[model samples]
Target chain A: MNRRALLGTAAAATFSGAMPGLVRAQAPGIKVGFVATLSGAGAALGTQLRDGWLLAVKHLDGKLGGLPAETLVIDDELKPDVAVTKVRAALERDKVNVVAGLVYSNILQAVFRPVTESGTFLISANAGPSTFAGRGCNPLFFTTSYQNDQVHATMGQVAQDEGYKRVFVMVPNYQAGKDAAAGFKSRFKGEVVDEIYVPLTQLDFSTELAKIAAAKPDAIFTFMPGALGVNLVRQYRQAGLASTPFLSSFTVDESTLPAQGEAALGFYTAANWAPDFPNEVSRRFVRDFEAAYGYVPGTYAAQAYDAAMLVDDGVKQAGGRLADKAALRAAMEKPGFTSVRGNFRMGANHYPVQDFYLCKVAKRPDGKLATETVRKVLSEDTDPYAAECRMR
Target chain B: MSLNLLLVQLLNGAQLGILLFLVAAGLTLVFGVMDFINLAHGVQYMLGAYVAATLGTLLGSFWLGLLLALPVSLLIGLLLEWVVFRHLYRRDHLAQVLATFGVILTVEDAVRAIWGSSPLAVPQPEGFAGGIEIMPGLTYPSFRLAIIAAGLLVALGLWLLVDRTRAGMLVRAGATNAPMVSALGVDIHKLFTLVFGIGAMLAGFAGALAGPVFAVAPGMGDGVLILAFVVIVIGGIGSIRGAFVAAILVGLIDTLGRAMLPDLLRLVMDASSARQTGAALASMLVYIVMAAILFLSPAGLFPVRRG
Candidate 1:
């Protein structure tokens, strides 16, 4: 074949190649591909995730599951098309045994087909969209992160329990935002006086703040992450609505707390894991992460670190063998992996069945904002859509 | 919405308008007088905020930081013009856009490298940090009111500078006919450089003012840049007055539309449909107005047409 034809043949091999990413018996080397958004607006989260993943690699002495492994990390740049293309390249060109590390839901959903259809095990460190938690669940896909709605649902339950009779909901207008609102409304007992879906890129919340003030809700619940989150929280306080008791889910994270400064103080939130979670693994992870990186790891980092650890456990269980997809998948599902968030188990749909914690932003002894896990809202909870997942 | 709510929303719109005007004023003048399209203009805004915030931490006072940031931002703007933008002045708009877009990427990456990707907090200036009661049972944030006053002051300053000064007359003349100004013993190159420098300073000033309210991050300028462009196009390419009018118009329409559309739609439609349609329509309202204005007057609302 000509050179162009040879390239085309290799490209075609991605589709027609028999059980595309089966580990070669001769090589027996594990190659894991990580795709996360490491650039653009919300890149700090991706950076922390990459750092945690790398720290896991370091802790393992450059081995996963007691076998020598190679990891290739790529930036998706927060674009779905770019993520899809990069994953394809990772599978086809690099021919990795496993794929991991996605921070955005839309990008994860975009790359789900290509990564899974190639018979490559895809472990998501973050972003478990609802589509994959239900009837659409794929056997080849596994998520170390909670379903996207899990934290929001916990917050909803918290708001209901707190006796907040009137709540104003605010979130960006997108799929994740819609999912968040739905999650909150499903469990919130209060009357939703107003549910405002602002544009995703909107930075100024004065108008929204004005509207919230007029409505005079008992509490304000918002799901804005990254820069938008920082902007919203700061503006909320600036608008003198700080007295209204702000609540959120993953919007006032450790990554954004510095930017929020004093404004983030006393804000209520819910998430799967926090730095102050009382566990040896959590403490060690947090300490080692801070010592190694000179900053505390947020939930994204914790999640990615867990993903790496889980992958390591799976490899160890498989006796350094991931060539058999079923064997590896079964191994990953086993309990007692020493996760930073303790006692993690995969539901039938492959999303985590873990505890969700109600958290608050408090200043640490060192004068840094950190999430303190106040109470457990959902213990060993599985997603609602897990019953719909046929993979069980 | 109640009358008080309406009034608040209008104020919100006006505040947003003034900020937009601050950025668009610089953008329109540069496009108008120099005939240069600098996509990196937004990055100047970003740089201003970054400088202000960084210095604010180092200086221990927001006012002092602002005082120091202005000169530093102006210097950086002038340096950018000297090193990168001067070469692009003779290029076509597409080439200028492509080159300046490259500058945007470089500047944003440079910012990320220097000051990580996390947003930075810039404390609001003292005495304007909280809200105040303007009427019975009504209170508004003092910082926003301060922003409005400052923006209007800058607008007035710009008007006086452009309309009342000899240099201003030259700029107006240059906007109308650069070659004629050049033929009349005026050094158009210096004029262009000065205009570019002033535009950068204006954008940076706006950025510094906005740092307290908005998230000071690497790509924060991208959104405002697009809106500033819209303001200039809708108002008139070369007219500062056009930019001012259009900036406020765009701001009010955007703010008020987003605030009131769903409620208005709820009166006629079901709640769910009203919300969905209202949000969709509200986002498109500004563009729709732009389209209608363009259709009605192809030269824009205040085109700088000379007989």
Candidate 2:
């Protein structure tokens, strides 16, 4: 070939390669990037999420909303910086139209700017930081999980409805911890005897248990997650407070109940979704998840599964083009899909306005640990901060 | 606080202190005698816990887990010493730190790969699941009490071994002057291997014991590892006696500070601010104490050279 023709062809190839998504727009279906904590501490929750999400995609036969979809799952390793880097790469390089699967609030907050700036529709499965629920809400962001404070608030209301007068609360010392306590106090009519905050990673709670024992409060409420929750609850039982009515929020759940053994039994916790939620979608999900993964799916999994459904519905509403951000966002905000947590509706802020169930850990007839939905504590609950969100 | 609460907290502090000592004993020894920095010492503790939990589950008895964990822990330690730690001994501290840090990453990832990164319950041995009333209205977990008793027994055994035995004498002498001990025709390499093995066993023992009380999961050792370092630093780097004292002090300060600091701060500040400041300060309590001690005594509280 002539030198000039060869140079022109080379330049054309380079330009098309740099802008692959624009050049080859309609060939591949919707691309969704999933980033979550898949490899570090508390990774069980992340693994459940990844599994649940993939199961949904698998069930749909690799198609989301009647369109061929490509999902790339990446582990954030529970690090914010890693999450940012991965999300950025997913957006800029992979050209994913949608991003999902953020389990921790800190991670969601960290990757918020980059994901939104890239104009990718970010649907969070687990984490729903309050910052994003309020004035900080972005049009590009949506959450399938409850706001961080909502469950604690529901637990507090449940405590009051159950006629617990004097309560002692404990939580890991962080923003979420403070929010938890504040949320509890918001609706709780009873007197809070004491509120103790410990290091988030503290494994040993003998001294605190002793204090709880000494205080002899009517009920004990806490918001410890992962191993911390396992240790604290087990230690509490070991301290001979099995008779004391213990309450928790996101502390004793499906993810932690296996390691917690009988210690978590009989305690009450509040969450937006549970395996025994009675809805057809939830029943099918829980049964299929157990059959596929050997263990029952936790709240994290349920939420992530719902997130996948949301993306599917959004893609359908957008006529199989998730690149149309406005239509996708509008479809996502509408309540149509049969969510595992029934009666699902998105608030103006893009966070779910759903019922929070007060669940009690009980042994099933077959002798397996399971959470029985006792009652709905909050009905069609909208986050208090949603009013401040100007997403409309 | 009431007198009962105070007494219980003091005992809790002692219990935590002893656990810290069990993990720190080997770390201090390795650091002191060999002049080696093995950050992977914490991973040894983690491996010990995992081994014990797995064995316990497989054998269906906690006692069996304990019985088997010691030798396994020692073997792993010896293996690591032979393959990786031995080479780093002659290198600079920075090299040792980096290499050991790499070992830490590898060990943590390996555990995660095997166990799937979820917390596992190491079943408390039969008859240790309940609490014992130590005094009027001051009931504590029987398992924790047993941990305290076991930790003390280990401490006693370690004291005798280090202070009265021939091997311990060599270890102590080596800590003071490694070259001088080597010049005396002592097989320094063999001695280091033995010391490393024993240290690994002690840390493993601690981890196994801690399995029932703490959550058995990957990276569980990292937090305790930092605390163990603080214990070794506060207690002299090579001084077993110093570690004993410093570990107890750290345990008490940390426990009491977390329990009492917020209440104390509430007296001076608003309730919310008190909690925020108190939690921040409580976390820093041990480091602060370490700094104060170092400022007062540059050589740890019980320097082996002085001993």
Candidate 3:
């Protein structure tokens, strides 16, 4: 419509034709796609991941390595097929050179191979399965989160250090659940009373709780997150066993902790990040996030924040050129992005080899629920399976 | 293990049975009376749990929350039936299923829009939170026993209403032939509304009862809906007595299979193998029972009187 616009379009076309190589030399904005379950049972965690990413991008003021950035977000709905298809669309249609934000290990496994094989960069915010941390690791895959086994292994170490001799293990019957159990058993050298594996979405835990109580272990450890975590904590409290020491690998996050309230009090949990880690970056994230969102950010948010920062560092390292996939990835391999969890370095397997903190819920000096940094459970904890990762 | 351990497992099995009966009772009635398959019935259960959690959190009392949630859920259930479910009454099973499936999507989304998709935990009553030692060595959750008692009471009340009262006569007759009941000067639409509302209330009640135990989140109804359908298939679609007994049987078998099968397997194998094999077998127990029942009695133990 405007005479000036038509003239600009004609001149732009002529200019683009004249300098084809100039386009490659110029600063190109990075396009990244994020896929996760954004509308189902795990939707809250997914939203947290999304928010963290947006906040990181917001902090960057729409720039990664001095070039503007664009993000493509898709909802996976917790279905493997849908997640895979979404990844393909983001890569092929959206033309995003890098993909990030996988919440579940199952979804990550469904996503990792396709993007890696296609020579696209995948920056995983969460869900680094041991296989990918180990023999299945690919050069294109980089996880900001620790391997799933690393967290569980640290949990086991916490239990062992606490002098727990008899423990009952419970996890939903699934691949990840089995992995959680095996990883814990690898580090835990105590007497195990029983291992009860229930269906993934089982609601009624009365029978299972009875069995757990019957085993009468010194302590009970479980691996159930999302809805399962809420259900288990509520039912465990209802089972009149609150006094019993409960250890969990993936529970007691900001997402579930508020809903749990006093019920989560005194529970021991292990994680790579917590709100009270005493780091300036983490403290600021907690303070500002609490003031803004009216709730604390969980590990889900923390991992996602790290993921975005990692991408930012990679883009900057590549001198703002995301089109060169290997150059951008090589830039990502060296770590200097200060995440909320302090400086995290990528290990040989592409998963973060970071510190694991054994934390217990206790009322701080102000009578607000916060995690007590019980101990640095593992320093520079690397996955045993990582040696098998053949990432070039 | 020991005798006390056996008693505890049995008690657990019975508790799960009672809860399943509460959910199955409504589903069987809806199918048997109206010849309508309502897939969103479980969504009402989710609504009930949500209402209870939000109300309980606001009021700081579990019982009060349950009380306040009942009317809200009932009104919601009736409105949904009037606006959505009533239209599907004349539709075929395929159409009804599709429409109700849409309802599931709308309701789950509505919950997410309102509650932000986080699992909300409703605390148990102060009194019922703890278990009671029934025997010298065995203790069972008092709240679970209360559930069993409540389920039995509802079952008895339903039996009296369907078998002993004049309204019961009409319902039974309507199950046999709705057109004939309409010919006797009763409005069929009114009957359908009443039946749908009651079925929804039962589902809401089950949802309410389960709130303290399970997290109230979007799509929590899916697993429960599948189990309730299994109950209907085994108990006979329209028969209330069949629903109750079949619900209990299925619940017991599923729960006990999960709890005991692995230990029983350990009688012959090592603990690890027994755990793995038992976990798999336990999950398959209910389906296996459903298959056996279908094989033995083609139309369930008691078919609806439509034929």
Interface RMSD of 1: 8.9
Summarize candidate 1's per-residue lDDT along B198-257 as a digit string, tens digits. 898888888988988899998899999999988999998978899999999999999999
Worst 10 residues of 3 chain A by lDDT: A16-25
Model 1 residue A2 lDDT? 34
Computed on C-alphas against the true complex, the DockQ of each candidate is 0.41, 0.43, 0.36
TM-score of each: 0.93, 0.93, 0.91
Which stretches in model 1 have alpha-carbon errors above 4 Å? Answer: A1-28, B134-139
Could you arrange the candidates by DockQ from highest to lowest? 2, 1, 3
Query: What fraction of the native alpha-carbon contacts across the interface, defined at 8 angstroms, is recovered by model 1?
Result: 0.50
- List the lowest-lDDT window of 10 residues for candidate 3 chain B: B133-142
Local lDDT at B290 for model 2: 96
| Candidate 2 TM-score, C-alpha based | 0.93
Q: Is candidate 2 or candidate 3 better by DockQ?
A: 2
lDDT of 3 by residue, B84-200 (tens): 988888899999999999889877766766666777767666577567865432346677777889899989988898899987788888889888889989987887777777888
- The CAPRI-style docking tier of model 3 reads acceptable
lDDT of 2 by residue, A1-392 (tens): 23322332233223222211121224468787887676667577777777788778877877788877777766676789877887888888988888899888888889999988877788899998888899999999999998888888998899889899899989889778888888898888898888888988797787788777777788988988888998987887777776878888888888888788888889989988777787788999988888777787888988999999988887888897656777877888895789998789998999998898899999887677878889888899999899998874
- Candidate 3 stretches with Cα past 4 Å from truth are A1-28, A323-327, A363-371, B134-139, B302-307
